[model samples]
Structure formats: C-alpha cells, structure tokens
Target: MALQSLQITALTAMRARDVSRPSREQQEAADRRPLRDETPRRDQPHRGRDR
Candidate 1:
C-alpha cells in the first residue's frame, strides 16, 4: 500500500539521520578535549608585564 511504503521510507530516513548524528557521549568527550591552541606554556617574557 502507498501508506505502508511511505512509512517505510520515513523510517529509513530517520535511521539514516540517526546514523549520521554523533551520540551525546561523543559530543561530551569532544567538549572535554583540549583546544587547537592548547600547549604547555613555558616561562616567557611578557611585554605587557614588562610595563
């Protein structure tokens, strides 16, 4: 039936959408990770502090 086919198509689309989306845990883990510029800072001269 047309309605059944439409339902199946919708379900398939939903499944595909879910598969493409990251899980909440993955998102949280990403949030906890270090940023791109994150690096160990060594004692360095600061021009502002020199003022």
Candidate 2:
C-alpha cells in the first residue's frame, strides 16, 4: 500500500540520518585527540596469549 511505503521511506531516512552523524561522546573523543592514530599496530606481538 502507499501508506506502508511512505512509512518505510521515512524510517529509512531517519536511520540514514542517525548513521551519518556521530554521538556526543564520539565527537568529544575526536575533539580531544584529532590527529592520534587509534589503530592497533601490526608489528607488536600479542601480550597475554601463551604459546
């Protein structure tokens, strides 16, 4: 039905908007350290696992 399609479209648009924007905590963390690299280094060996 046309009404169901409209509702689905509205829901999809809302979800897209939500996904496009970051939350307040994320924005604050980004602001605190804008240039720091957060990724784990591949050269470092795992510390806790026993071989």
Candidate 3:
C-alpha cells in the first residue's frame, strides 16, 4: 500500500504548477514566443541575361 505522505494526486499537482506560475496571460505570451534565433535570408533574384 502507498504511504499517505508520499501520495500525490493529479489535481493537486496541476494546481501547484498553476499557482506557482506568473499571471496566466504572461505565461501564455512567453510560451508563444519563438525559439529560433534568426531566420535564413531569402535567396536574391539573379540578373537576367543582357539583351
């Protein structure tokens, strides 16, 4: 049998994480931010053959 003190239910775990986090809106904004450092430059068009 599991010990009472060691037991952790899913709802309590979820609530702990939710409470420790910053305001919900700011947390959401940070999560949405991009991970990539820089985007690759698009290839430049080449000059057409001289007439």
Worst 10 residues of 1 by lDDT: 1-10
Model 2 lowest lDDT segment of ten: 33-42
Candidate closer to the true structure by TM-score (higher is better), 2 or 3: 2
Question: Which 10 consecutive positions of candidate 3 have the poorest summed lDDT?
Answer: 34-43
Instruction: Enumerate residue pairs that collide in model 1.
Output: none
**TM-scores vs. true structure, each candidate:** 0.41, 0.39, 0.35
Which predicted model would earn the best TM-score? 1
Residue pairs that clash (backbone atoms under 3 angstroms), model 3? none
**lDDT against true structure, model 1:** 0.85
lDDT of 3 by residue, 7-26 (tens): 77899999999888799899
lDDT of 3: 0.80
Write model 1 residue lDDT over 1-51, tens digit each, in one string: 776665557889999999999899999999899887895777999878887
Candidate 2 accuracy as lDDT: 0.80
Instruction: Tell me each candidate's RMSD, in Å, in order.
Output: 10.6, 6.0, 11.5
Residue 36 of model 3, lDDT score: 65
Backbone clashes, candidate 2: 0
